[model samples]
Target chain A: MADMIQIEHLKKCFGDLCAVNDLSFRVKEGELFAFLGVNGAGKSTTINIICGQLKKDGGNVKICETDLDKEPDLIKRSLGVVFQGSVLDKDLTVKDNLESRAALYGIHGTKFKERLSELARLLDFEDLLRRPVGKLSGGQKRRIDIARALLHKPKILILDEPTTGLDPQTRTLLWGVVEKLRKQENLTVFLTTHYMEEAADADFVIILDHGKIAAEGTPLTLKNTYTGDFITLYGVSEDDIKKLGKPYERIRDAFRVSVPDTHAATELIIKNPDMFRDYEITKGKMDDVFLAVTGKSIGITGGEQ
Target chain B: MNELFALTKRNTKLYFKDKGMFFSSLITPVILLVLYSTFLKKVYDDSFRSALLAAGADISDSVLNGCVGGQLVSSLLAVSCVTVAFCSNLLMIKDKTSGAIHDLTITPVRFGVLGFSYYLSTLFSTLIVSFCAALVSLLYLAVVGWYLTAADVALLILDVFLLTMFGTALSSCINFFLTTDGQASAVGTIVSAGYGFICGAYMPISNFGNGLKNVLSFLPGTYGTSLLRNHFLRGTFAEMKNQGFPNEVVEAIRESVDCNLEFFGTKVEIGAMYLIICASILLLIGIYITMNIIAGKKRK
Candidate 1:
């Protein structure tokens, strides 16, 4: 896939504080890329800069090979954004809100109606179109927000924590819609989320911490490279776990070590099962790998240790 | 232009959704008019009647009569105050709170277009409220036997439009200074109240001395109330000329009033230049603040 979004040495600062420090990344065309970060991470800031809602202190961003600074209007025309907070006018019915947004892009005539109907059918929003947004449930409102963003048939879709406040069932429903968009329209998606499950499905993921990219790779590559299969560990206290030495790692408050295969771990377990009382020998999941690489637990307190 | 129309429609829909705002704008003017009318009636009967009697020649009947026109002016003032305080401040706050402004900023739309659309919506809402107040006042005047003319009606509509623009501009300025909705509304109320008193919204400018009168003439509301009074009570533009109120003094007042009214009319040729300037300044400040927010969010 061609490079859809490219950021090189992007830096943003406020006074003495550096919000995004020398950030660089590239999102491929037709790829569902996940930007995973804790609260207060630079995810939203980076998204804002890409969307031209903000001016960067120094750096470059390009969309579809077009420089954001040089042709902001052209770039903006190619992108759609669903902000973290609700952006719908509460007093307006879902249909009216969508129609107003359509009008903003100057979409009109029979084509506009076709687009509206298409989005309504795809998002299952037809039933709720006449309902006032204020009266809709949180999940319904989110669907409407998504529909509004997709009204103009943008080449790229940026969802900023789109399912943060949604229930699990609703989140699953939204994820399905996202998947459909990716497959059906070949839309490039750059989504920010704290949900590991959400990021797991992305083609690529960028883990951010404290205004910097902590790690970046596909989910499987990141896990395989940063973590290992399994090994039983013994003789480690809460304080001693930190002192357990090289190659051995900690996962979820327990000391762990990776071995070549299950037989090796079993032989070790057979020898000293009591040594692994608080510890467990198992295949490393993405969460453990993320923690191992970033020195912090995924979805934990600001993704900190 | 299409974008602006869409924005205007969206804003109008939002305004209609807030039932509390709609009701407050509708009923508050009537209550204020009634209260002020009652108070003026008591004062006229108790003190003004004896004073008129002392001046001689059967002034009792006229003295006993209520100042329905003054009540109308008071109602208009009340409605203007509420509209300015509620509409502009809330609109600004909603943009920030709801994150809609951020969405618009990221779009292809220019800030100028967005600001103009908001001002247009505010102007429209204020016009509707002012028309409703004027209709109620006209009913009262009819009952009390006060004559009105077509030119007077045109003058009244123009007066409301000018005041609404001024109020929208003032509120936009306040919104830029204050970050929160509560602070914006509080500051807007105090500012509007101060202007209300100075602009002779509650009293006759003629009672004040020359220095104060000159200061009052500089106020936007002063021009609005004068134009409105010229229509509803003083009769026609030609009649105003024949009243013998001193051409020089009247001309001075007219010139000063004309400055405020004409600032949005022929002199400016924009219909909303002052408002546009105020919005531009405030919008620039707001953009700066938003940039800071983005920077702050990034560093964390």
Candidate 2:
């Protein structure tokens, strides 16, 4: 796949503090690439720089091989951005907002009408067009924002935590819309999300931590490299589980012994049948991989116990 | 360009929909006109009128005519000043609080376009408010048998246009200076009030001492009121050349008056220039700030 976006040694600093430090990444064409990070991680900032809402301190950003600094208009023309907030005008009806955005990209007349109709169908915005945007629910507003961003028919769509604050049902609906767009338009999607499950759907994930990429690879590869397969150990009390240090892994309330294969699990179970009777073994999930790489567990309530 | 226009139109509609703002902008002038007319009738009694007449004052014609014109000009200036100070600040704050500015920044639209669109909307709002106020005052004057020529009406409209432009420019500049919405509105109110008092929007500059008159005369509103007074009351642009003062003081008044016109014209020019310079500067600053925040995000 061709490189849709290329970033080289990008850096941004505020006074004495560095916000994005020496960051480099490439988003391939026709790929749903996930940028994963915790809250306050620079995901939105990166999107801002890419969309020309913000500027980098030192770096070269290229869209389809056109340098952003040299040709921001050309680059922006081919890029669509859905910010964390719903950017729709509250006073205007949804249709007006969409029409205005379409006109911004110089889309009009028959071409605009066609795109509007197509977006309305795809995003389920048909019934909501005449209504004032301020009256819409949060989910509907987000959908309108997505529609507005895509009206220009951008080559690359940048969604900055697009599903944040949404209910699970809405998130699922949005995901379906995104997936459909990817398939129908061959669009390259650059999405930022803290939700591991959402990241799982991406072809590649870049886990960001503290202004740097902590790990980057296909989700499966990163999991395999950073974590281990399962080896269940029974007859271990809570205290015993805590004492079983080095190689033994405790994910949530379950204790697992890392094993190279099923044979190792079976041998361990046979050695302590009574202890293993109540235990079940499974492959390492993305949560375990996240814990192993960051030395922290997914959904851990507080500091380490 | 089309997008900007669409945005402007939407904002203009919003301005009209705001009942409190609409009333203050359009109705406040008429209310002031009524109040001032009643007050003048009581103060300018027969004794004072005869005294002024004995002193070579044209009490029979110019006093009544000028007083009518004065009240109209004062009410219009007050309305425009208040409307610009409050409405423009509110709009800017709304954009910031609602994330509209962030949304605009990310779009392919340039910052210059966004700022220009905002100014255009403000200009439109001022014109509407000013016209409504002038129409009301004209009706009141006609009922009282104070007639005006076509030239007077034309000049009055022109002066209102200049005032609207001045107000729009000041509002844009205020938005640029203030960051938060609350702070912007608060500061705008204080500044507007101070300027209104200093420019003698409610009183004649002639009532002030020499030192104060010198200072107040430099205000754009002062020149605007003088030009307006000359047109609506005296019915000639040349009437503005001399403000009924002694020869030595007349030069000082002219100098200060000239400064205000030059300053008002400069504001219009700056407003146009700000479409480029202010937008670019703010955009750059916003980018720099956001970039660092993003960098911080990468660390976590």
Candidate 3:
């Protein structure tokens, strides 16, 4: 697949502090790309530069084969960005907000109405057209935000932490809509999220720490490379695990032993069948992989950990 | 061009839909009218009465009351038009704080168009509210005995239009740096309270000391105030002339009521006042456009 977004040595600074330092990444067309980082990890800064909202101190950015510096307007047309905060006018109804934004992209008359209606149905917000954005719930507002981003039929959708404050159920539903759109529209999605589980679903993930990429790969590959499979034993004594342990962590009333893979875990279990009467082997989680690479636990969500 | 109109429409709609902002902008002129009628009416009436009495001109109380009403209305509009502009233009700061500007800028819309939309929006909203204030002033004039000709009314509208342009440009330039609600309101409060006194809107510059008047003379807003004062009180001046009052006495009343302002000891005629106001409007608009262009260049 062709690359939809290509950034080389992207650098941005604020006074003396470096926000995005010599960062480089590529997002291919029709791929779900996740840029994961903790708070203030330069995720929004990078997205702003890509969307032409902020100036880059140094970089070469090409969007859809068009140089960003030379033709930012063309690049902007292909990008639909949902920023971290809600940008809809609080006093205006959802339809009005969407229509106004669509008008900015030169979508009007029958085309605007058709696009809005289609997005309203696709995002399951048909009933919310008349409701003012300020009165909507957080999840409802987020759906409208997504619908607004896709109003112009943008080829690439950039969502900057769209699910940060949403409930788990809402987050799942939001993702369902996004996944459906990606499939139906063949969208190249550039997502920045703090949720490891969300990042785990991406076709490619790049973990950023302190304005630099700590690791980048498919979720499973990242897990296999940075973390190890584990065997959890219930009702196992610490001393008994210590005798056979390569390395182990105590979890409340249970103990988890690290191994190279499921096979190694199975072999360890077989070798010590008497000692491992209540143990089960499990694959490593993406959270563990993120922890291994960034040396900080983003866990399931920023709120959770 | 469509993008500019659409954005401008959105901004104007947002301002009107904001009940607090819309009502606040309208209520300011009414509040000032009430205060002026209550407190400043007697002072202005006494000043006019004393002038006529000193010249032995037997002007009736109705004509004197009409003159006083015109002065109050003109003074109030001079400040209200600009101050309400500072209030109406808060939409720009609100958009900044709410991250709407970021959302808009990321679209295919050109940044220059986006900035121009803001300027146009402020102009439209300010004009609407200022016209409403003018209508209210007209109603008040009816009560006090209308002395204005049809031409005076037309000129009043033109003066209000020019002042609105000045207010929009001046507020847009100043409010560009405002980023938060607190900062915007603070600046709004300061401008609303202090601008009237500085521009000789609340009181005639004739009452002020020479030093302060000289300083006020250099400010463009002083000429804007004088323009409104001229249109508003010209009928009253013509009434004095028709009643057989001598030109010297009429000129004294004109000077007392600030119909003619002096810029550094040079009297500014009505034509010169319009020129100064227009020049100031252009200067302010130029500054605002330059600011937007420089900001755009910085991003590049």
Q: What tens digits encode model 1's per-residue C-alpha lDDT throughout B37-145?
A: 6775565345544543454423323212323343346336534643543443356567776788776666676665676666667667766776677677766666654
The fnat of each candidate, in order, is 0.60, 0.42, 0.75
Question: How accurate locally is residue A143 in candidate 1, as Cα lDDT from 0 to 100?
Answer: 89
Q: Write the per-residue lDDT of candidate 3 for residues A144-169, one digit (tens) a residue.
A: 99998898888999998899889988
DockQ-wise, the better of 2 and 3 is: 3
lDDT over C-alpha atoms for residue A270 of model 2: 73
Q: Which candidate is the best by lDDT?
A: 3
**Candidate 3 interface RMSD after superposing interface residues:** 0.9
Off by over 4 Å in 1: A231-257, A260-283, A300-305, B44-89, B176-178, B235-300
Top model number, TM-score: 3
List model 3 lDDT by residue over B1-300, tens digit each.
879888998998899899988888887788898999899899878877776788788787777877888889999999988998999888878998888988888888876677778889889988998999899998888888688899999999999999999989899999988999999999989999999989889878999999999988988888888888888888888887898889998898888879988877888899988898899999998888888878766665
For all predicted structures, in order, the TM-scores are 0.80, 0.80, 0.94
- Model 1: which residue pairs collide? A19-B298, A19-B299
lDDT of 2 by residue, A1-305 (tens): 89999999888877777777888999998899988666545666677788776768988889988898877778878888888778777877898777767777778779888999998898888999899899999999989989988888889988887887788888888989888889988899998865677777789888776668888999888866786567666557756544434267666756777765556667766765656656776666766666676676534221221
Chain B TM-score, all predictions listed: 0.70, 0.69, 0.96
Clashing pairs in 3: none
lDDT per residue, candidate 2, B46-94, as tens digits?
4344644564544334434444444445445544544453454356557
Q: How close is candidate 2 to the true structure, as a TM-score?
A: 0.80
Q: DockQ (Cα-based) per candidate?
A: 0.36, 0.30, 0.76
Candidate 2's C-alpha lDDT? 0.66
